[model samples]
Target: MKEYIERVTDGEDLSLSEARTASSLVFEAATEAQIGALLSALRAKGETEAEIAGFAQGMRDAARTIDPDRRPLVDTCGTGGDGHDTINVSTTSAFVVAGAGVPVAKHGNYSVSSSS
Candidate 1:
């Protein structure tokens, strides 16, 4: 965690593997301060595609599996950090899709940068 914080603070992008490991650490071991610093640094430096993918994979790995009765499912989620005060479009879209008889699996952490 400290290594990730230091590396990101130095504006050096982590390799996909590094990002993955760091993300795993975030869920399993990193302190709130460490997570905050890492996220801030990544935001300041702008996350790369590999970093995003690796982090997403790490989160997916840590998530609990849900069986949907073998039915098709869709999720309406955003990358967040939209920096907007507007309504959450993804959340609204999920309801709309569900109302239209489609299965929706909307999920995300609370926004840290926006009102949504």
Candidate 2:
């Protein structure tokens, strides 16, 4: 993890596996300061698509998911948060999907102001 941190601090991107490890560490039962350092360091180095995907994959794996045997298994997921330009397309799409007799499982979150 420290090596990954060093790579990122040196403006080098982490490999997919390293990113995955770093992502897991963020959610570990550790101190907030430790988490903050990880986040802050990553933020300072700017984000990479591979890193972001690895992080999201880690978080998704940790999340509670529905059983695969559930009926009406339709997904209309969204990334959420359109800043001040949200047009509710995702919400509208959910309604449309449900109206078509498909069980729409929409997942999203409130808009957050992330630092650049």
Clashing pairs in 1: none
C-alpha root-mean-square deviation, candidate 1:
5.9
TM-score of 2: 0.55
Estimate the TM-score of every prediction: 0.61, 0.55
Which parts of model 1 are misplaced by more than 4 Å? 70-116
lDDT by residue for model 1 (37-104), tens: 99999999999999999999999889977667747778666645577766777877888888989888
Question: What local lDDT score does residue 70 receive in model 2, on the 0 to 100 scale?
Answer: 68
- Best-fitting candidate, measured by lDDT? 1
**Which digits, one per residue and each the tens of the lDDT, describe model 2 over residues 1-116?**
56666778788987777788777777775467767766778899998989898888878767767665768767665544556555657777888888888776777675453211
> lDDT, candidate 1, residue 108?
78
Best by TM-score: 1
- Kindly give the stretch of ten consecutive residues in candidate 2 with the minimal lDDT sum: 107-116
